[model samples]
Target: MKAIYLESINAPFVLIEKEKPTAGPGEAVVQVKAAALNHRDVYIQYGRYFTKEYPAILGSDGAGIVTEVGAGVAPDWVSKEVVLDPSTDWGDNPGVHSKEYKVLGMPQEGTFAEYVKVPATNLHEKPAHLSFEQAAALPLAGVTAWRTLFTKCALQPGEKVLITGIGGGVALAALQFAVALGAQVWVTSSSEEKIEKAKALGATGGINYKTENWGKALKADVGGIDVSIDGAAGEGFVQLVKVANPAGRIGMYGGTTGMIGQINPAEIFWKQLNIYGSTMGTNQDFAAMMAFVREKKVTPVVDSTFRLEETEHAMRYMEAGKQFGKIVLRVG
Candidate 1:
């Protein structure tokens, strides 16, 4: 078997031959057909993640066929086409994850190889509508978007939604899911090209965040936003607050820009606004996300594809931030 091996921090992710992984008890070995890149994979190279490991196989999302199943697993699982849920040991609490929780790519071998083993519980039958590459793109970003809107915000139909950084995978998924649920969507981006593309994807309109007072302008143009989803909670997060309708919900998934800075307590209290911090979701959330994608026939936007041998180049492309959607790695 061949896998992308990260030898150390700041090292290249090189393809290396290795013994194929075997299924452990209650686990299954998937023959990966496709895998998707997340910023987390890039963060590992720079040693920027909260957790890190050397000589690692880093990939969080993948689609594949189960070729081997361990003891206690159903025989039916073998040869099943599946998309894996990266979240594990989510514990009993639905509102938040437990200390045992870990994503697939770190501290455990992930989907960057021709064969990877995972707990069978993480496998869900792949959506029939999606190709392997498309299914590979759905897990992490899809669940992140799903938890932000549907779980944290409880988004309602006919309400207005504001998704920041429209070109990224999670943001794109948020926009698509919101639209599919009958919400009117708007987005924020520095790239005019991305904004236009977002509009084509059911967003009503979008504004260039580079423009002065862009937040105020968006509020004026769209009226009040009922739910706003953002991964970058930088200085612009306050602006999301500025644009929200009274009693609106704001879901923050990541802090790419760092620091919440200062927020006006008065605005939050006066409007009765809800600010919810979120991450890649619980098992229940993954189940609901899968069901939603299946029911709505949601297809993830594939920005590009690269062979597993080109994992290094793909990582750089993702780091460049030029991609408008998920960048996938095609595996054997």
Candidate 2:
């Protein structure tokens, strides 16, 4: 089996041959078809996120066909196409995994390979409407966006939302989901070119944060927003505070702008705004998101695709902050 192995922090991933893993009890071995990249991968690679053991496999979202089902798994699961959930839990016991917790690809081996073995519960039916590449793109970013909007912020129809950083996978997903829910979407990006891309994705308006003060622009042009979807938690959080309407919510996820930001207490008190922090969602959230994808035909915005062995190039593109959406690796 060919896998991309991270030998050291902040170093390039290497393609290497390793023995294919066998399914353990309650686990299944999948022949991976496609894997998607996220900003979390970059942070993990640079030691800014998950702490890694040597030679870690680095992909968290992927789709594939089930090849083997271990003991205690149902027979019908074998030979079925599936998407990896990435989130996991250990029964009602609290040990290696919590009573309700653990994330695949964080402390365990991940899907940057020809095969991956995970608990049968972590597998989900791939939306019939998606190709392997499309399904691969959905698991992490899609779930995160759904959790942020529908779960955390509870965005309402016809409301205004100011989304930060238009090109990233999560932001792009949030934009489409917001529009589908009938919200008027306002987006921001550092590049004008990227802003145009957001417009193509149904954003009602986009601000080139490079040339414009997004906070002031939102206040003047869009009349302030009802919700602010902020994945980049930098100086921009202050902007979020400025642009939100009274009783508005700021959904914060990533720290693409270096993890720290300022919050004005007076404004927070005056506006009575809510700051919501969301991470990847529950298995139930993933199921509902898939239903939305299937019924609404909402496709993920893929920026580019690469061959499995070309993962290093994909990582480089993500690190350069050049992609307008998810980057995928065509595995198997």
**How does each model score on lDDT?**
0.94, 0.85
Worst 10 residues of 2 by lDDT: 90-99
Per-residue lDDT of model 2, residues 175-265, tens digit only:
9888887899988887888888888878888887765456887788988899888888877788889888999999987786775557769
TM per candidate: 0.98, 0.93
Question: Looking at model 1, which ten-residue stretch has the lowest summed lDDT?
Answer: 207-216
**RMSD of each candidate?**
0.9, 2.7
- The TM-score of predicted model 1 comes to 0.98
* Top of the candidates by TM-score: 1
